[model samples]
Target: MSFGTEMENKDFKSTFSGYSKVEVDQFIAKMMVEFNSLSRENNNLKKDNESNQEKINYYMTLEKTMQNSMEIAQKTLKFSQNQAEKAKAHADKEADHIILKAKEKAKAILDHTNEKNELLKNEYDKYYNEFETFKIRVANFIEVQKNVFSTSPEDLELSPLDLTSFEEYVLKNIADSSEEVDDDELTLPELFDDEIDHNEDAQEHDDNLVKG
Candidate 1:
């Protein structure tokens, strides 16, 4: 009886030990599954971080490019403004030069006109003086002819005088006188001889008429 009891106790202890080993193996398998799940999640988080960093770098590059473009635009605008100002200054100078030239031309024209007017006035004055001198000379010639004819004696008859014959004789005498008398060399006695000879002939002709 004692041997059988000891054998039964040993058999019970062996069965319990076998169940503990199986439980420990199952626990180890569950822990391994949990560890693998955690490792996969960590790898996925690292990939997401890399992708976010690449996006931030791209945005930073775009910002730098835009800043350079803005700087270039500002420089171009300043250059255009400078060119405009230079062109305006040059145009103003050209306009002033043209105005000065026009003024000079106008002054020259006015001076020329004034000179011409003065020349014309002087010419008119000279012509008027010459005309007045001619008129005075004509009047003096008529007066001298009248005085010489009036002082002549009426009885010194050369012919029965018609108007035509008298005019012919007077014209002939005028022509002969012009040839013989030089005004600068003529003496006063020569001028009186013609009147004295005519009066003596008139007195002699009257004495003969009274006797007839």
Candidate 2:
């Protein structure tokens, strides 16, 4: 209860030897004022303590929340790092696979090219050998003509029987040699053309001698 209300209800009994009422009342009044002031101050201090306690409680809750958030953030960071590593490993594996496939494809292409080159080489050798054989045959035919043409026209007697034998042998040999070669098979060399031109000139000279 307030000191003012308590003092109003208090009753002081007067006696013959009791202290003076006026002085005692004045002292009690001063003490009541000081007590009321101290009570008000104590109430205000209680209010301040309650407010400070509330602030401390809020800060504690905020700190706990921050700790939880930090934990979550760290976990998220670790998870992201793990995912990145996995992705990098997968990408590296894919790259290696691509490189391996490319190398295999390149090797296959090289092998095929080598095989094609070998076939072409074989074809060229076959054609070259055929060309050489053809040259030899042409040389032999030219040698036969040279042997026949070496005789002077004066030395060739014009007997009917001898003329028939000479014509039959020369014509038969020429026709057989001509039939052996087909124009479509092989391309004649420049040397063949030159040799053929030379033979044609010799044959023309021999015809002139026969006519004379």
Candidate 3:
């Protein structure tokens, strides 16, 4: 019989030389004590095993959670990198536009300065040419007037003192009559057949103008 069935049945075979009844009963009692101790130990071992299994399951769950957190962190880092790249690109584009605008502004300013300088140079050349023409016209007029007076016929007769006073009056009137003359509006004398020299008169007039 199985050990468990034998223990429960407690039936013993009797013979003419069987063991003592009290001794057998005592042995059975001792065996039952040992079996009961083993049963309690087995139950404690089962409880320990169950506790170990529960710990293993909790550790598995924690590991899975840690893995998920790592994945999330990686994804966040990638997203941030993408955003940084985009922001940098935008900043670069804006900087290029600003640089281009500054270049255009500088070019415009340079072109305007060049144009203004050209206009000033042209005006200076024009004024110099007009002054030269005015000087030539004045010299020609003085030469013609000198020649006409030197060759003129003398018809009027008067006292020497009266003639002197009349000449002075005429010179004063001619000197004062043409103040603020415009060269552009002046009517030049007709050209003579030959060139006339008025270098001395021109030099004297220029000196007088400078002194005034």
Candidates' TM-scores?
Answer: 0.48, 0.61, 0.58
Please list the C-alpha lDDT of all candidates, in the order they appear: 0.59, 0.72, 0.64
Per-residue lDDT of model 2, residues 36-145, tens digit only: 78888999999999999999999999999999999999999999999999999999999999999999999999999899778668856765666576576676567656
Native-to-model Cα distance after best TM-score fit, residue 80 in candidate 1, in Å: 1.1
Residue-wise C-alpha lDDT for candidate 3, range 48-143, written one tens digit per residue:
989999999999999999999999999999999999999999999999999999999999999998997786678557656655655665554565
Model 2 quality (TM-score): 0.61
210: Cα error in model 3, Å:
29
lDDT of 3 at 87: 100
Segments in model 2 whose C-alpha atoms lie over 4 Å from true places: 1-8, 12-24, 148-212
Over 108-151, each residue of candidate 1 has an lDDT whose tens digit, in order, gives 99998788668657755754564454345334435545744664
Prediction RMSDs, each to the true structure: 22.5, 12.1, 11.3
